[model samples]
Target: MTITPLHFVGVSALLFGIGLLVVLTRRNAIGVLMGIELMLNAVNVQLVTFDRVYGPERLDGQLFSLFVITVAAAEAVVGLALILAVYRSRGTVAVDDLHELRG
Candidate 1:
């Protein structure tokens, strides 16, 4: 009935793999952003798991996870805003089409 670090690690690995696949296969900018978010979440899961395993006895894992969630929220907002601007300017959200930025 106890959750182990190994369990959390396995879940994190699965999420990382799925996120990698999404990044590799999707061409839409939004899809890529989602993949990046997924990967970040996976990293957060690992960090919290480690903190729980070895940190002081004050539930630091949950605290760090909260900070990560906050940062992720800000990142998502900024990233979506940028994506919206690009879509408005370029009329497309495809990753391949973003090369127009190259000078």
Candidate 2:
């Protein structure tokens, strides 16, 4: 069978679902970051897929995806820095361990 927009959407949904699951269940900071990244990628895929189906000439979807990628990069850097700081202080990267940061 030939690949279609529906297929892309399906895969995107699956990836998003898996990412959400990871975010909900994982206790590690790094794992949760990875899940967020996965969810972003799924959104990128859907954006491109819909753009392709609508009209590839405009390339609006590609541009939006690029913007998202830039944001994701910034998020990763900031997130990793915070995670590292937490790990340095607590000696653990678990999300639950971060409660100590509260006043």
Candidate 3:
């Protein structure tokens, strides 16, 4: 009864799938950003799992995961800022309400 890397991979896959679904189905920009964050977290989990299972001597996997985390943070900040700006201008955050680009 021990945890394994395979279990982490399976969970990561499930999270990625759910994240993808959320990104695809949600009309709100914030919801889509949340999905993207979930997907990024799944990737971080896989990176850490693989590092623990195979690359204990090297910190490459963990380092990469940290980089991903940093990027995800940056993305969330910038994305939320943009969403806020849009909402302020349009009065709604619905994706469908953003029809100013119809050309």
What's each prediction's TM-score? 0.83, 0.92, 0.93
* lDDT digits (tens) for residues 22-102 of candidate 3: 999999989999999999999999999999887568988999999999999999999999999998888888887888777
- Lowest summed lDDT over 10 consecutive residues: which window, candidate 1? 94-103
Separate clash counts for every candidate: 0, 0, 0
Query: Between which residue pairs do clashes occur in model 2?
Result: none
Best by the TM-score measure:
3
TM-score, predicted candidate 3 vs. hidden true structure? 0.93
Which residue runs does candidate 1 get wrong by more than 4 Å?
1-3
Backbone clashes in candidate 3 total: 0
Evaluated against the true structure, the overall lDDT of model 2 is 0.93
Locate the minimum summed-lDDT window of 10 residues in model 3: 94-103
Those runs of model 2 whose alpha carbons end farther than 4 Å from true positions after fitting are: 101-103
Score residue 31 of candidate 2 by CA lDDT.
Answer: 99
Write model 2 residue lDDT over 18-50, tens digit each, in one string.
999999999999999999999999999999998
